[model samples]
Target chain A: MIGTLILVVCCLLSTERLIIHAPRPGRLRTPDLITLRSDQRFAQLKAVLPTTGVLGYVEAPGTVNAAHYYLAQYALAPLVVDYSPQHALVVGNFFADSPPDLSPNLLLIKDFGDGVLLLANKDVR
Target chain B: MAVALAAFLCFASGFALVSLFSSGTVPDASAVLFNLTLSAGFGLGIFSLAFFLARIFAISNIIAVDAAVLVCLIAALLLARNASASTNLLMFSPGADEQWPRWLRRILVAATSLALCGALYAAIMQALAHPQGGGWDAFAIWNLHARFLFLAGSHWRDGFSSLIPWSHPDYPLLVPAAIANFWTFIGHDDPHVPAAVGLLLTFAAVGLLFSSLSMLRGRVAAMLASLTLLATPFFIEQGTWQYADIPLAFFFLATIALLAVSDEQSLARGSSSSGFLALAGITAGFAGWTKNEGVLFVCGIILARQIVFLRAGRKRSEINPSFHRHSSAFLLGCAPVILLIIYCKHRLAPPGDLFTSPASMLHRLLEPFRFEIVVKAFLRRFFSFGGWLGIPGTVLLLAFYFIVGRGQRRGLPAGHRASILALFLTFIGYFCVYLITPYDLFWHLRFSLDRLFLQLWPSTVFLFFLLITPQKLPLSSNVSR
Candidate 1:
């Protein structure tokens, strides 16, 4: 019985080492974000986004923007978060390093700088 | 400090509730632990109740939580003054029965302390590392829902909107509601609150494990049982993560613990209102309030108890009179929470992930290949859960059982046996869920089977230690076993 317990203790100490120190500069523990804070790019728009109602959401076509859409939705919750730019107003999130080129119909509503763009949907019903 | 004080108020209210509904069979042990475990369990139940009321009245705020909890505390304090505590556990306590060598006792005590402090430290550091959450589910589902409830004001229902189908809006709201209530009390959202809730439940589960065993089984059994649970890596991590599984597990173990306490109290008095059974049923019902699987546990425990009662009937029909009373007491405690859950499912939430169509479920059930995959995955995950360093805790428990022998001590009571059966039935319910899942069988099993296994892991250790332990164990005289 003592041997068994000693073994259990040893296992606990060793396994905990990997768990505690696994996340390093070059090593990613898992793909999920470590924190839920919004980027400063959204600092302006997040405050100005409509307080309620469906908010159409659009972002640059890439894996990173898709992830950002999730973040934007989280930031602007209680409002209906949709992936298409079909609502009366749409949030145009673009990469801070490379902003998206505009289409003909997405009229600029506001540019909450650092890559956060808001557009009024001309094609809205 | 404010969070700690609020938690204390919550614990006081829970202790008062326990006193009101108690059978006076509380065992002699660490008063702090006993109070903390019961308080955490009772606190969650009360918080959920208050949150539910707030939603109904559109008044979920710090004032509402403070008003509700303070009222409960005051009323309980006034009423519980007349309540009595039991000393029957004194007979089984250390030094009262068998005196172990001081050296051996020290070793056991040290081991318990080490496991606890180590787990607590690791859990805090892990939570500190992930300020957002421990995993994807925290921010995506639980905390996200809390954000809606906390920040959206009257529009909190938007968190349950169908637009976010993957968020499992249909899931019960105990963890989120409790967190949101805490956030509301502090007047804003803070990641520390969820991290702390996780901490409270994790250690509370530990406290329950240790205190319950010490009361019923003996001090050694309590220490060993708690040590095993504390040693589990995943239980600690999941407890730190802002997830519902650990909350569900807490309620699950509370149900089993309360049943044992009720049984012990009833036997002591010869016949009494099994208020503990009622509380156990309520805890199980609140389990449903924690997650979808908890609903299954509520039904499973009730059915398991009934089956055991009926089985006991053929041998002793005279006990049938008390059986009905106990059953009714349980239902009375459980029905209100079950009603709340039913309301949530029907009124506030969307459909669940599984069984979207009766036809698809029927098709899935008949496929032998899916069955094989799920069964295989269950077998594999069962052995490696909680990131255990070596053999899984379950396997270690089984080995211990084999070594100790499976004989039911002649002194073991019927009610205790009944509770064990209910736990087994809950496991069976989990197995059946795997068989009829709507998702790809292997993928579903691999991703979730470990966590699902963890839900029962603590209870399994508790029951295993309870059964294998002698009806009367003598303290070891030797320093080394």
Candidate 2:
């Protein structure tokens, strides 16, 4: 009797999770947004970036967190994405409409037109 | 399409290899499922090893390497066709089907099939919703490493550079290398490859649980146990998240299952089943390759087997003559992967972060507050970790087991006892690691304790079910000892 009861409960709970987590029409979850948005954002930059080297990264301050940084890293893998602005080439992940305040040592090298900016670091030889 | 073909090839390679050791040429339904489940895991593991070696040797044509591997496995399979049918892998007893009423068996089977379909739907929906994977670890660690290996060409070793310390460069490369291997065959990286691998491993775990129970207990017990696993929402969630936890859990369960089967075959044949033990060792090695926690499990299993054998030897007045043979076979099977792991840690990757200094570790281990925190968290998560609705599934199941009472069998089967001991030792290892973790105690426990519990949950379920002899069934008298 106990075994039967547990099986019933399991069936009910599994059904509940199935119903709750099933993808609905026109619904985009955050993970989906991360993959789609990040891939589209970095598609062109990936072509210009060296296939294998460490590059400095700066994001719009407080506008994003580790998720965006990880997505950027994911989209441009084989190239190490460091979270500091100390390398010869740095990536500027700022909103296209809201341009980021740059330090004097950083110069815009190319704007890949999706808030994906390549900046040259004058501090490095 | 390329991903599908790669998976099929993996399945084929694994099946052929496992067939080399299995006893039965003509298998029953349950045995077929058991063989196929092991085949999936073994196939992926072997392919990953082959791919890693190919990379190490600077072989660019991975497709050719895989094809050659498949062809060699096929050749071995053909050559070994007439070897032996002396040992049965299924371990089913006489009159196993008659132990439960036909109607009850039908109900359990139907319910289990229905629940399986529902779980599959949920897993698919979850995978579709997160094509990049279900968690940050997937993209940041597992898939990110795959991208490195797939894209770096001659410089694949750069993926393990210290510049990306957060990526856990010291971790073993089974998942990453497996995904990258498939991508190399396809000639492009697709998110589908990892997603498919994750789903296959997840379901293979379910299938293993079901078949192993069916072989050991009866169909009724098997279905009920599998239902509990499928019912656990987080098991499915973690699996679709594409983290290594599911793969880790799969191998843990596989090792345990293989050990149990080996013991059963040894008892039935009146000789040591070294073949099964060798397979167990391989699975345990694969566990080590899956995650660092897996290395702990490998140690735990070794220690547990030693203690179990020692106790048994004490009762018998001398150690069993087969112990040395069994140990040697297991170590032989485990050697290649262990060597690979050694090379990976020493040559390719940076030092792991956990055991930086003994003094600091001992200092952390001595803190009473840390122990208290870890103990409380472990106790709390043990019941609630599966994220089941209302009453937690594990607690409920334990309560039911007590209520039903252990049947006439005086003790658990020796294999079951050994597996339980291994799991307990592994649990203790987890506790100790928690006591000495360098990260903030509360934060680390909050994030990882659940996954740690999850890694052992399937094997725990199998062992628990193995102990419960169903007395309420109509043919209880006929149930095997």
Against the unseen true structure, what C-alpha lDDT does each candidate score? 0.72, 0.81
lDDT of 1: 0.72
Off by over 4 Å in 1: A1-33, A39-41, A64-67, A102-105, B1-5, B23-27, B60-62, B80-103, B317-321, B405-412, B472-481
Instruction: Chain A only: list TM-scores of all candidates.
Output: 0.72, 0.81
For each candidate, what's the DockQ? 0.33, 0.54
lDDT of 2 by residue, A1-125 (tens): 55566656665676577557667634545447467678889999999888888999988777867777888888888888888889999988887485678888999999888688999899986
Which window of ten consecutive residues has the lowest lDDT sum in model 2 chain B?
B472-481
Residue-wise C-alpha lDDT for candidate 2, range B1-481, written one tens digit per residue: 7767787788888888787766443456777898999999999998898888999999988877888889998887667655643444434553655756778777777777877887888888888878778778988899988888889988889889877647888888899999999998788888888898899999999999998877766777788779888878888888888899999999999999888767765654455557778888999999999999998899888888887887776654333458768978778877789889988888888888888889999999999999999999988997786877777777867676766644424555455677899999999999999899899999989888899999999999887777775322222211121
TM-score of each: 0.89, 0.94
True contacts kept of each: 0.17, 0.50
